[model samples]
Target: MQGYSAASLKPIFDTHIKNDAQVLADGWCGYNPLKEECPNLKQTLSNKGKNFKMLHIQIRDFKNWLRGVHSYCNKEYLQKYIDEYFFRFNRRNHRKINFR
Candidate 1:
């Protein structure tokens, strides 16, 4: 986002996250406003990423994939690249299943 402010995050949360979905985030002030919009929002200290080990790993892997595979990305298409990566990542275990 342009900045980690509530205004910057609101649109993303509204577009991508369901209101009823449980959301976990670091105890950042930017996420405070989101609690009103998302009833299930939870905030806690990150403990230097230890509290979110798997999430950190996934982020690291995505960065590595971006650097290794694309080398560079256009700012305009960065979101599309992230979406594609997570689409595959989310379905990695279900590859044997047919979509149709």
Candidate 2:
């Protein structure tokens, strides 16, 4: 695993997010490379009101959803479970498009 190394973040920065987008992250050595990669990168210390608030909220919700709905997941199939959740989460606004 790359585990927060500069090498690990290169491709994600290169491919996933656009250069114009702002990259907000907590102060971690792993994210240090982002400064060089992104023009709008903002790395803040892990203090109150400094962290990415909504991102942290979403992460908390995901963990709660996993613990509450799945109870316990096997390591072998955890990726599948997370994928399923994202599938539902991504299309959550289209409840009555065709039906209505």
Candidate 3:
């Protein structure tokens, strides 16, 4: 949600996330705004609240993957490219690519 405004998340969540799907995220303040924007959303932040619903999916995994592909990539592009990379990784024998 770095580059994305609260308004843009609707299409992304509706189209991509679907229902009954769990969302794992970090402690970024941007997600706070998303609470109102996404009604179905179950966001998790590392910094606030209790009984963390959001899985603290390691940024290192994604960052290393993105960094391996190309440096200077920020969170805006990171989500897209990481999804693409994970797709390829899942398809390629589950061996996966080393981003580092």
Candidate 4:
């Protein structure tokens, strides 16, 4: 995160987000080239009024879930854990239809 090189961020941003998706970020140099990388990217900067409130809440909830359920997850397995969390969260409302 300290370096703004595309090589360093490709794995996190390029791989996870689609080229047409808009990106929201703080006024950080790392995100400055988002529009350049993805021509359709609508980059937004939050100068005030809790720009990252939803993201912050999700991270906080994820941390709490990990701490409460797993006690302490290792860094190596954190991404997989996060992926599973997203999977379950995304399908939460489908459980009723799925079982019946």
lDDT tens digits, residues 9-77, model 2?
Answer: 878888898988888777778777677758788878868743667777877888999999999999999
Structure candidate 2, residue pairs in collision = none
**Model 1 residue 63 lDDT?**
98
Highest TM-score model number: 2
Q: Against the correct fold, how does model 2 do in TM-score?
A: 0.81
lDDT of 2: 0.80
**Between candidates 2 and 4, which one is better according to lDDT?**
2
After superposition on all CA atoms, what RMSD does each candidate show versus the true structure?
2.7, 2.2, 6.8, 3.3
Model 4: weakest 10-residue lDDT segment is 40-49
Whichever of 3 and 4 has more TM-score, that candidate is 4
Ranking by lDDT: 1, 2, 4, 3
TM-score of each: 0.73, 0.81, 0.42, 0.69
Q: What do the candidate models score in CA lDDT, each in turn?
A: 0.92, 0.80, 0.61, 0.75
Better of 1 and 4 by lDDT: 1
Q: Which candidate model has the greater lDDT, 3 or 4?
A: 4
Alpha-carbon shift of residue 78 in model 3 (angstroms): 7.2
Q: Write the per-residue lDDT of candidate 4 for residues 1-100, one digit (tens) a residue.
A: 5576666777787679888776665666665566677776554566453777788788888888888888988999988999988987789899997778
Report the lDDT tens digits of candidate 1 across residue range 1-100.
6877999999999999999999999999989888998989999899999999999999999999999989999999999999989988889888779464
